[model samples]
Target: MTKRVFIIAAVSLYIISAYFSFYYFSTGSISGLTQKINLPLVKYKPPVDSKGNVIIDTSAPKTEECPLSGEMLTKAHKALWEKRRPLGVMIENSIDARPQSGLTSADIIYEAVAEGGITRFLAVFYCKDSDGYVGPVRSARVYFIDMLSEYGDFPLYAHVGGANCNRTTGSGCGNGAPADALGKIAKLKWVSYNDLNHIPYPVMWRDYDRLPNRATEHTVYSTTVKLWAYAGEKRKLSNVDDEGNEWNSQFDGWKFKDDESVNPSEAGKIDFIFWQGKSDYDVTWEYDSKGNSYKRLNGGTPHLNKNNDKQIEAKNVVIVFMAESTARDNYTEGSHLLYKTTGDGEAIIFQDGKAIKGRWRKKDVFTRIKFYDTRGSEVALNRGQVFIEILPKGNTVNY
Candidate 1:
């Protein structure tokens, strides 16, 4: 009887494996399988107000424009954001960290290669609130720090760890290392003020259940509500800092406009890779006419947000080509990298199902990067989520 039962169990397992194998081979991808398996178990609940009301109400009229992305929002939404400073979270982009949460809620997302060919995101949140978790949180890099500087004075920066100096020798990535993010944070007086490095539990926690079998490195998760609450309650930071100054008093935000009606195009896709032959990190943005937005795909699969199982979409996709170089800090594992973040560079802005060949300029690290069209006029991006891709200067962007 025991032998007969074992044989039956083995046959059952084999049949299940064979079925999935056949599906994978036919589709050339397992994303369909992932969706089928994961969607059923989803019990996600969006955040709620004190009265148990859902914070995001799509039916409400959106009149207040977001200072970060110029996306209009309801008065209720603006009230919540008005009490908090801009929050920038470091989210990893490894294959294991797929279907990242809360990306669809970010006002602006900045993507760049963190190490080797693997990319990372600096998701900026201010005007909008995420309905669910925000990360598989990751370490920081110095360039992301510079990009976040444009948000406001001492915006909330959340990360696990960052490129820092050797604690004992104090030599590896100290004051002068280009990739010494912690060093820069300290120099800017943000060590304990607004920089959240490996925040305590409840604010940021590890969830092995979100994606089973994920390595420990990809389990750290946080939410905008928690981070903002921590910032306000623990760190004494909000829309106004401890010094009684507003966060966006000096912020030079980009211009925004409503979507433009355009003729349908036969081809409306943008594809590129951060590093050569790193196909898993390749990115594609497909323009959708009805939505007037560009849907994102990573590694040839729809990049869905785990919170709502919705594909990532953006109103504007800006590609900035900059010179990339290794920091040569000589850490034992591998040298860090640096990008030309503060300067003029060739850029391509995609909106209205079309491309605008342009240039980007940032006078300094604290200055907002602005895009200019071929005619030398500042381009007004569509009013919604803006995704900025920082690619190597020589990389080709196929559209």
Candidate 2:
């Protein structure tokens, strides 16, 4: 019991294990060795709820605030986006795909029609910035996968093929296999993208200065940063839905207006038409109220944003009449429209400049859609940016 007290306790446990290994490699953080590695560091602090907002904790710490846009986000967009998934994309609304490319940084845009009546754009991008240069990119539609399963953020579709076919002659418009809609979004394994396997390199491209002025099928294009770095190197991007489903990430009711001085109900102002006339899927919007915002026209003009010339504004458009159909493209004679973004509809909701017929309500196939008004309430919008439209019922609203 005494080799000089066991060599002075093994040289004081080797100088406290070399001073906690030089204090954890000179503070590469063990938070000062949490009581010398006793280890309990839990200080999360996220819970806010009673409308103060903050509550999404995907394990909290990438600088948060983007659980679908409570804004202020960027830690590489909360660590490489796709947190609660929702990316859709597929834009290309003819008239030579006019100035399109990340549709004014979409948070929601649907438009509809496609396959001849022209219009086509699903856009969506969860809480913003998918990387940019969003596209002339187009295709894949079965009602844009029922408007990405009625907007419960069920996305990750991205496109460059559908409504017929071409990925190097795997067929033609109305092509077979799982009966189109990009081969039923590649047989429901959903995580789609159609650069026909160019992999990590070309998500889709061909702008030879707008490729000899449009039509190699609107000069194929892509770039939400090479479509999420080629769907995260082919694991094929996910926040779920290869059957796993996941994505009720909940942004909750999206109401807003505790201050844009409460607008939405001029009952009908400046315009918002949606196929009453001037086709190309009629989309109008107008309503400036000195930038209380609306803008986007297309077919009556304006609607810019080829990445930046401006124009395409919005505070909310919505519309959603619902009830169109046609379906029949087993490869050509063209025409595969459909669009019923799921159950009940009528919803008007323009905003600031006014209009609010409202009623949309979608509750199933994964929730979150509500629009209400005609007294049933809900119609709260104004927090900025939304286009939706998706018309049907004999169209013709003109405001």
Candidate 3:
């Protein structure tokens, strides 16, 4: 009986030892595997995809209709103003380019105001394109103008450069004092071959110089004009462009001196405003000239010659608001990462005070934000503050 009892005890001890050995080995293996898989502790909700790749979420609440007229803003208009802000506003007499139709004769209006004590103006011109995307090519010119005129007398500066559509090999035009008749009206300070580099996508001076066509669209010119009220007192100011060109108080007026085509009736048709230390104006033409049926006064001439006779023949003027930044500073271009934290609720993003569409995960430890353009390619954000708000699920109050 004693031998049988001892045998049973030995078997029990062996079984317990074997079980502990297996448990320790399995536990150690699992620990090593966990270390190798070191993933982010925060749960990230990846963006949804369509066929094979990820797509940008642009279905958010956008300003579709024109803020003033209640008409739907077209894709082109949105694309232009989405990343630009006006230092001043100008309205010229012209026709609508979208519908390609003429309107009843009206006076051209220009208005300027001060923002944060800095004078700026908004210029609006009617455009008509007969064979372009829109009907008669009616369009507007929206951009920033220097406010140095307020300090003294500075000539109006325009930036005609390459479009962001193609970044590889594009440039701006440099039509300054020496080339154009500006020497008599204003002094050409500098000519640069680059676009204005603000936030988001800072325009690099070196890149501007590297552009191929320096005299064409790859260059920008700046000139200064002096306005003497009475005595020989001289008031000096500076006008600068993206290329770092400086204009002082010695520039002559419009260079197209030989073009003796001035209509008295058209004089009152164009209006002007001085705001933000800048001069903003618009000109409207009543009839097409004999030489050029399509050209009008105050219009952007394709070439430097006076033969084109491009005129500003617009009617209804709509002032579109320009954003404060460029494409590089406003959107996340190239490769970038955005992070956001959310409670057990919902989150929303707004650009220029409008909501962007997409689903956001709740209670996620950390979330990543990515941006892309209409073509599903990555984009860069320009300079300016974007509004971001986080709210609880089903709760109107933002967190």
What's model 1's overall lDDT?
Answer: 0.90
Please give, for residues 124-187, the per-residue lDDT of candidate 3 as tens digits.
1111011111001111122122212221123332223211222232211121111121221222
Cα lDDT computed for each candidate against the true fold: 0.90, 0.63, 0.24
Residue-by-residue lDDT tens digits, candidate 2, 1-399: 699999999999999989877888766546656644445796444455796534444443444444432344444455445544666777778777777776877767777777556777778776656435767776676767666665554456766656545556544443243235655665555533422322223666667585366667676677665555555456444565445556565545466562264353563344444444436545566666656778877776788886667888877777778887665435445556666566677877777766767689776544666788887878666655677777677666765
Candidate whose lDDT is highest:
1
Give me the runs in candidate 1 sitting further than 4 Å from their true place.
1-54, 167-171
Supply the TM-score for candidate 3: 0.19
CA deviation > 4 Å runs, candidate 2: 1-64, 67-86, 89-106, 118-138, 141-155, 158-258, 263-315, 318-350, 353-385, 388-399
Model 3: lDDT of residue 246: 46
Off by over 4 Å in 3: 1-63, 68-72, 87-284, 287-310, 317-399
- What lDDT is reached at residue 384 by model 3? 18
For each candidate, what TM-score against the reference? Answer: 0.85, 0.30, 0.19
Report the Cα lDDT for candidate 2. 0.63
Ten contiguous residues with the weakest lDDT in model 1: 35-44
